[model samples]
Target: MDHRDMRISDAERERVVAQLNTAVAEGRLTIAEFEDRVDGVLRARTFGEIEPYVTDLPVQQVKPPEESELRSRSSSLKRRGRWTVPRRLTIVTLSSSVKLDFTEAIFGAAVVDVVLDAHSSSVELVLPAGAVADVDSIYTHASTVKSRIEPSGGGVQFRISGEVSTSSVKLRYQRRFWRWRW
Candidate 1:
């Protein structure tokens, strides 16, 4: 997607700069290189402009199984009833704010239904749990979840230093009995 389409916010840019600074301090980037790249990021007006530099930086990796296999398995597993666990989650972000809520109870579990709403700015909906059986299920196939949930609770609030906004979030709860579920 185009950097303009990505709609990254100023706060996110600051965050990226902070991370870059850390990397430089740790010797991951030389002072001169750091200053140059940092300047580039600061000057960047779109996500596309900042992506090439940041995409290569060290980050976590998560990949899903082949789609065919996943679909076939999901279909077969659907018959078992016990093989799948469905949960309902409602996430609400306040005006001009971004939020993420994770429940330890569902940590590493499968998310069947994810509901998201955004009003302004950009929202990032992330599932960092390793226990989730199908990240693609909620993200790609279902499309209920977005790469970044936009700021929807209200308008975006620019904070000078303190908390910029408050996010109201909720996640539904359910458990599957399948032994291999995960």
Candidate 2:
């Protein structure tokens, strides 16, 4: 028979032989069983002939209707203005330490400002005054930063910091669950 007409690549046959040898070495199959399986793989005339050996493994399939419906609904909410994109700006500092200053007017109504200080060895976050004003409760999820909402004269400050090479900051609107990160 022509080598090409056999419909089995040399690499594929070698891989099956290796697997059969390993199975016998591991005592999962007797020498007779291993030889039979290896021969079958080598003699496979079409891809279908190898199906029985691979059927037990999981295979990928298209998503079902119920899953597709849920995905469509979730995407529709984003287009309906339920989520707002927060403004993000990146600033580079050359000084050993830097301080950022801002006021409520810098951010429009219901918008919060987030400042990320990215230094060579440290990172810091500063939240605007109105970020969480309307919320009845406040909880922090990240352990890196020591968060504090303190009355500074007539305004409030939310600050967090840690040792970091680069700083990323996000402005979050609690009620809308909208965020802008930089």
Candidate 3:
């Protein structure tokens, strides 16, 4: 039997689903078409059966940035608009303000790991819809980490682990409407 005739595993199926997600995000497939293809992928029993679902799609061979670091002292740092998010990010600040807006950013990986080392600073992350963050593993000293979004494990996962001294870390969803500030 050929390799295509071999049986497929669940992990392989999930990888295809991830590819389908990327395709949809990149506007290569419509929502309805994605739904149909996902249904077919679920019903597929062999490699040959799943080949047609993505054979026409371009292979995503572009490697995302490995890691990113943002450091500041007595200054403010902000990231907004369309940008490629790396898998790992480190932020170190002292007496500064850092804001990361991910509403229009591209997620390179499903899981993003953030390491924070801050002192007397404020860190704010404005995430998109369906994105969740976990700040349970962070160590704080006279610092407060607040988040309105709960980590339910459905969409993109942000594993935040770090230490904050006299700092503040807040995670919130993007606002749909504009709010005027006086």
The candidate scoring highest on lDDT is: 3
- Best first by lDDT, ranked: 3, 1, 2
Best by TM-score: 3
* Weakest lDDT window of 10 consecutive positions for candidate 2: 67-76
What is the clash count for each candidate, in the order shown? 14, 0, 0
Q: Which 10-residue window of candidate 3 scores lowest in summed lDDT? A: 173-182
**Residue-wise C-alpha lDDT for candidate 2, range 40-153, written one tens digit per residue:** 888786556755653443332322122111111111111111122233323333223332323212222233323333333122333444433222222223313333433333
Any idea what lDDT model 1 has?
A: 0.41
Instruction: Write candidate 1's Cα lDDT for 1-182 as tens digits.
Output: 65456867665686688778777777888898888888989888878788766775786232322121111111111122212122443333334333332322221123334443433222333332322322232222212332322233232111111111222222222223876421
* TM-score per model over all chains: 0.33, 0.26, 0.65
Model 2, CA-based lDDT = 0.38
Task: For each candidate in the order shown, give its overall lDDT on alpha carbons.
Answer: 0.41, 0.38, 0.89
